[model samples]
Target: MQARLDQELARKGELIHRWSEGSLHEVDLIEEDYFTMLAALNRKVSSLRESIASLEGTPPPRVAPEELLANWTAGSLHQRRAILKRYLHSITVHPPLPSSQFDRAPLVKTRLAPHWKTAAEVTA
Candidate 1:
């Protein structure tokens, strides 16, 4: 949206420059387009400000283990680390049992605050 607004502003500047240079013969049509573009740019800026205001103080929503796993798999190393650090205070992983596959349950432990509930916890 910001990029589009910037492009429109550049077009408006070009229009004015052309009008000042006496190259544009259709003065009335160009004037109408300039004002319409200006109004649209103002509306875009106002909408962005309102969106920022709405998100400014709000906490992010919690995610389930499945969603977390999906994000973890798709994220970069830094992003994955950030997610781990944000959601867990501490984690412990035990070695797999002999001749058995690795199991997340009964081996891994996480310490999250009571206020930060996962989606599964909330639904349960």
Candidate 2:
């Protein structure tokens, strides 16, 4: 098992569950996948603004994703900053634990329960 990956995912999952009740919160993908979705949404929003500008006489310049999320349209600066900062942090600097730590062999039925064994035996 990738310990770091599992820990990151569990942390993200807990945050998502506590803050959101949407289907997206129940999603089972990596943080990278979530960030990619954010990027896609940001791109689509930029495209929409360009389209709107062509229709309207004048539309203001599009904002960068960080700034846009940092200053959310429907919320206070405190809420916006907190949410955006967490989102941005989640987007970067996450690395999975090494695969060598994963248990690869089929689980064998042993005479004793796992808890019955010594810690050293468990490590072995």
Candidate 3:
């Protein structure tokens, strides 16, 4: 869409230049068409710029941890899944260690999104 608009604008500019130099055959007709085409091209470029601005605007605000945990505890399955998908990169589960070591061993590990970096990591 942007490329087409640029091409049309370039063509209109060339026509205007030719009309100014008295090279276009129909001066009055070409003048009217040139201005009309220029207006339409300007409108299209403005609309495209607005569309791009909307897309480039700030992203959705991050969910707070306390609110997120509360939602996870009380939300429906779908809601919980959505939160997990948005914030967590992966989860790894490990088999239980032998009885003697099980108490001290970790069973699951989680990788949260980069935006959720800890205070220590942030300070470093």
**Stretches of model 1 off by over 4 angstroms after superposition:** 1-29, 58-124
Clashes in predicted model 1: 0
lDDT of 1: 0.51
lDDT string for model 3 (60-90, tens) is 2333576456545544466566656655556
TM-score of each: 0.28, 0.33, 0.34
Instruction: Compute the lDDT of residue 39 as modeled in candidate 2.
Output: 47
Clashes, model 2:
1
| Tens digits of lDDT, candidate 1, 5-120 | 45654664575466557676565556455445544543554465445445674432334477466446544566566666665545444445555754556443332222343645
Displacement of residue 56 (Cα, Å) in model 2 is: 1.3
- Is 1 or 2 the stronger prediction by TM-score? 2
lDDT of 1 at 114: 29
Q: What is the lDDT of residue 51 in candidate 3?
A: 56
TM-score of 1: 0.28
Best by lDDT: 3
